[model samples]
Target: MNKFIKLAAAAAVAMSTGTAAWAADYNLTISSWTGPNHGINALMWPGLIEMIEEATDGKVTAEVKLGLAPPPAQMDLVMDGAADMTIIFHGYQPGRFVGTKLIELPGYEGNAEAASVAYWRVYEEHLAALDEHRGVKVMGLSTHGPGQIHSNKEVTSIADLDGLKTRLPGGVASDIGRELGMIGIQVPAPKVYETLASDAADAVAMPYEGRVGFKLTEVAENVYEMPGGFYRGSFAFLMSQETFDSLPEDLQKALDEKVFGEPASRMLGQAWDEIDRIGREATVEAESNTITIASEQDQMLYGQYADLITKQVLAELNAAGIDAEAAYEMVKAEMAAQ
Candidate 1:
C-alpha cells in the first residue's frame, strides 16, 4: 500500500509539471523597415527578441519577418492585420500625424536614451488614453539619431542651396529647404539615388543611414553636418488593436513585460547611432569627393534657421487650435535641464 501511494503521488506531480510547461508556449510575428539582411536585423531586432524570450522564460518566441514592403506601406499593413507589428515613421504620413508633432520640436531634447523612455512614458500617461492611438498599441515613440546632410554640391552656407534641386521626402526637410532658400522636390525615397544619379536633382537631404543602404557615397560626396539632428524624424513600433486584443492574457502580459514597461535605452539607441556612423563611412569611402561640412559658425546660423522654422511650426500648430506653447516650453525646459 505504501509503494502504491508513493507511485500515485509521483504521477500527480509529473502531470502538474507537464500542464505548467504546456501553458508556457507563446508565438508572435514581427517586422521592420530594416530588411532581414541589415545589421539592425542582426543586432537590435534579435537582441530585443532575446530579451523578451528570456524574460518570459522561453515561453514566448518571435518570428521576425522583414522586407515585406516599402516604408510607406508599414502603417497600413499593421492596421489591416497583414502584419502583427512594425516600426513606422510618421513623416511618411504627412498631415495625418498632427497630434504627434509635440515630439518633433526642434533642438528640444535631453539624452535621447532618457528622452525616448520618457517619451513613451509621457505618451502612455497622456496620449495613449486618447482616441488618436486607438487603432494601434504603441510599443514606443522615439526619434533615434542626430542627422547631417549629404549632397552632391557643397552646402557651406545657405546660399549654396539656391536653385539646387534636392531630394527630400516630406515634413521638416521640405520646410527647411524652403526656409533656407533651396527649391525642393518631393519624391519617393527609393527613387532618390536614381534622381541624383540621373541628374533629376543636384543633392539629397537625409540622415547618414541611407548612405549605406543606398550606397550614397558613389554619387554624392559633400556632407554637411547639421547636429542636434535638425532633420531627424520620429518613429514608433506598434501592434494592431485587434491582434493585441486577440492574444491570450498571459501571453499579452509577457509582451507587456518584455516590450513595454522600459528597455535599457542602449537597445534602442544603438541602432540609430549606428546608422549615422555607417552613413558617414559610406561618404568617406566614396572616390574623388570633397566633403565641405558646416563649421561652428555655419552651425550657429543653422541654429537660427532651425529657430525660424520652429516659429513656422508654432504658427501651423496654432492655426489648428493646438496650444503648443506649454509643450514647447516643456521641451525646451527638458533640453535645458539636461
Candidate 2:
C-alpha cells in the first residue's frame, strides 16, 4: 500500500506540472477603445481569440480589455508595450500612413471582405516597400465598408455637402471632405455620437455600420449614400513586436499559418460587411431616420472627384517610390477576382 501511494504521488506531481505549463504558454491582452457592444468587440475579437486558441492547441490565448487608451493612442500603447495588441484606423494618424490610402480611395466596387483581401495582397506584393508600419507587426489590413454621409439635416445633392461641419476620419476622408467643400472636424469613431449630439459636427462620414455602432441613427437621422461611397476607412490590426517575439517559435508558426495575414483580414472584413447590413436594417426600422440614395447626376459628379483623388494618391505613392499606378491596377484586378 505504501509503494502504491508513492507512485500515485509522482503521477499527480507530473500531471500538475503539465497542467501549469499548458495553462498559459502565452497570454496576450488586446486593448480596445470601442464600446463593448461594438461589432469588433462583440464579434470579431471573440472569433479571433477562438481561432488563436484553436490554432495554438490551447497553448496561447487572448483577452480583450476596454479603455486601456483612446482610439488614436492605441498604436502607441501597443508599441510601448502597454498592450499586446490593438487596432488603429490609419486615417486617424494623418501623415503616419500613406500606403494605406490605396485601399481607402473611393470607387472600389466590392464588399469589405474582397477589398480587405485584395488590400493584403497588394500590400504584400507592392506596397510593402513603404514600411509604414515599422514598429509593430501588422497582423491584418482591412477597410470598412464604403463611407456615407450621416447628418441631422437632409442631404440630397452633392452641393448640400458643402460647408457642413463634418466629422471626417482623417486620411482619404479628409481629401474627399475638402473636395466636397466640407468643414472638417476630426474625431475618432467612438466620440462620434457625442460630437453629433453636442452639435460639434453637423455631419459625419462613415460606413453604414456607424449608424448603429456609434448610435448615429439616434442623433443624425439622415443618411446620404453615394454608390461605392465617398471613401473607405483603412485599419490595421497590430501586435507588439516585443510580445510577438517573446512567443514560442511553434506558437508563432501556428499564428502565421492559421490566424494572421489574409485569413485575419478576411475575417475582419466579413464582420464589417455583416455589421453594415445590421446597421442599415436597424436604421430603416427606426422611424426617425431616413435613408437617401444619391441621384445619378450627383453620383457622376462624385465619381469625377474620385478620379481626381485617385490620381492624387497615385502621384503621392509614386513620389514615395511605390509604383502606385501598378499597385492600383493590381488591387482592382484582385478585387475583381474575389
Candidate 3:
C-alpha cells in the first residue's frame, strides 16, 4: 500500500512537469515616451517584441504604450505605478550614471551603431554587476546615432558660431554649446517649429540624417558636423523595480530572451542607419543644407576640446568615487576592438 501511494505521487509530479512544457501565461507592459509607431524606439525595438510574442506562441506578450507621457515625468511615473516600464535620460539624473563611462565621453567621431553595440556588450559584462545602476532596472541603453548642427547660417569657423541662439538639448550639450559661444536655448522638441518661426532660436542640433517629424529641412540651412559631437546623448529603457518583481519568472525570462539580447543590433543599428539615410535625403532636398566637413585645423582644435572636457568629466567622476578613467578606457577599448 505504501509503495502504491509513492508511485501515484511520482506520476502526478511527472504529469505536472509535462504540462509545464507546453505553454504558460506571460505578459508585461512597456511604457515609452516616443510613439511606438515611430522614432528611435520604433525604428529598432518593435521587432524584438514581435519576435517574443511569436516565439512564445502567444502565451507571452509585450504590451507597448508608446508616447504615453512627457519624458521628464517618466521615471517617476514608472516608480509611482503609472507605468511598468519606460525609457528616461541618464543625464536627467546627473551624477547618477557618472563613471559608467558613457554619457558624453568624447572621441566618438567614427560610428554610432558600432559604438552602441560595443558599449552595451561591455556594460553587460562589467558595469551591470558593479552597482552603477542601483535603484533602477535598465532594459537597454544607447545613444542617438550621432548629432550634427543644422542651422540657418553657415558655421564655417569659430567666428561663425558666436552669438547664435541655438536650440540645445540641455545638460552637457547645452554646457558645450555655451562654451562654444552660442546662446543656448532649451525649448522642448515639440515647440521647435514655433520657436524657429518666432526667431526664438536660430538653429537646432539634430542627427546628420533620418529624423522623421522634427523637420530640420524646413528650418535650418547649414549643418555643422561637430567633430566630437556637442554631446553623445544616450537614452535608457527602465522598469520599476516593483513592477519587475511582480512578474512571474517565466515572463522575465521571456522578456530577456525575446527583446534584450542580440536584438539590439537589429533595432538600434537598423534605426540609426535609416535615420542616417533619411538625413542624406533631407539635406539634398533642402538644397540649402550645406555640410561643412571639419578641416584639418578644425579637427586639430577639437582635439584640445576633447582633452579639456574629458579631463573635467573624468575629474568630476573620480571625485564621486568611481574609476572614471577605467570607464573611459573601456569605451575606447570597445571602439578599437571594432
Candidate 4:
C-alpha cells in the first residue's frame, strides 16, 4: 500500500485503541485547518489524542474537527471556547508574534524534533514572559522541518528568485523573501494548491512536507532546496484555559506533568520529520518533479542573506523586550545537545 493508505490505517488503529473502554470523562474537540489527508490530521492529531488519553489514564480524550476556523483564527477560536484545542501557525498573524519568531529564523541545524523540544524549553525560560499566547493554555510548541522553495519555475540560483511571485508565510520567511527581491504573496496553507493552480503565484516557501500535504507535486513541480532550509515555521498546540480549569485537579496535573509540554512537542516534531521524509520520497516518485540543490557558490551567497535577516529579527525582538539573542543561542545549543 501507498504511504497515504498506511497513514489511514495507522490513524484507524490509534483512534481505536487510544480511548477508554468506558466513555472519557472529558472529551475535547480539536480544530484543524489541514485537509484529512494531510499528516497533521492523519498522524499528528491522532497521536496527540492518544497521548492525552494515556496521560490522563483515559479520563481525557480529544477528536479533531476541520474547518472550525481558518488557520489564523485558531487561537481566538480556542480562547472563545469554540474549540477545546487547536494548532496555530505563529506567522499567520504578524506583529502579534515577536518572540515566537526565534525558532522560525534560518540556519537552525536540527530536525523538527530537537527544535520543538528546545522551543518548549526556550518558551518557558524566556518567551512566556511576553504572554503572546496570553489567553489560552499552550499545550505544546513545534516547528516544521526546514522550509524550501517550491515552484513551477526553476530556481537554480538565489538571483533567479528576483521578480518571482511566491506565497510566503509571513515571518522570517517574508524577511528572506524581501532580501531575495521576490514578490510576496500571502495566503493560508490550505489555499496554496489553488493559488498555484490558478497561476496567482509562481512559487511558495514551505517545508518538504508540503509536497504531499498541500499536493505541491501536482501544482509546484520543482523544489529548490537550500541546506537547513530557508526557515522553519513555528506552531503552537493550544488548549482552552477554561477547558483546563474545568478539569479536576488530578486530571489537570496528569495532563500537565505527562502530556502537555515537551512530550507533546516532541511527538508532533517527530511526526513532522516523518511526513517531511515522506514528502521528499513522494517528490522523487513524481516523474515530473525535480529538486535542485543550491550550488556551493549560491549557498555561500545565501548565508550572507540569512545573516542579514537573522540580525534584523533579533533586533526587533530585543526592542520588544525579549532576550532574543539569548533565546537564539539557546535554540542552537539545545539543538546541538540533542
Give the candidate number with the greatest lDDT.
4
In candidate 3, what are the lDDT values of residues 1-338, reduced to their tens digit? Answer: 34224333433332232332335465556666543323544444454445655655666554556556776677777777777667665555545555443555567654666667666775665556556555567666666656667777668765567788888766556656766788888765656667776778888765664234466667776777766565666666677778667766776686677666445543665556566666656576666567777777876776676677778777776676656677777777776776
Compared with the true structure, all predictions reach lDDT values of 0.63, 0.87, 0.62, 0.91
- After superposing candidate 4 on the true structure, give the runs of residues whose Cα lies further than 4 Å from its correct spot: 10-22
Pick by TM-score: which candidate is best?
4
Q: What lDDT score is found at residue 60 in candidate 4?
A: 86
Clash list (residue pairs), candidate 3? 44-267, 209-275, 209-279, 210-275, 210-279
Candidate 4: residue 251 Cα off by (Å): 0.4
- Give one digit per residue, the lDDT tens place, for model 2 in 1-338: 34224333433332232342348677788898887667777667766776788888988777778889988899999999999999899988888888899999999989999999999999999888898888899999999899999999888889999999999999999998999899999988999999999999999999998887788989999999998989999999999999989998998999999999999999999989987987898789899999999999998988899999999999989988998999999999999999
Candidates 3 and 4, the one with greater TM-score: 4
Model 1 over residues 1-338: C-alpha lDDT tens digits? 34224333433332232332445565556766653334345445555666766667777655567567788788788888788777776767788665465566557555455455555554554444434555787766665555456677766766677778887666776678777777787675666777888878888877676676555676777767765655656667777778778867886787777665456334565556655565566567666655566678877887898888888877766665556565566545544553
Candidate 4: pairs in clash: none
Each candidate structure's TM-score, on Cα atoms with residue i matched to residue i, is 0.80, 0.93, 0.80, 0.97
Worst 10 residues of 1 by lDDT: 11-20
Native-to-model Cα distance after best TM-score fit, residue 302 in candidate 4, in Å = 0.7
Candidate 4, 1-338: lDDT as tens digits: 38989887765654443436347887788888988778888888888888888888788887777788999999999999899999999999999999988999888999999999999999999999999999999999999999999999988889899999999999989989999999999999999999999999999999999999899999999999999999999999999999999999999999899999999999999999999999999999999999999999999999999999999999998998998889999999999999
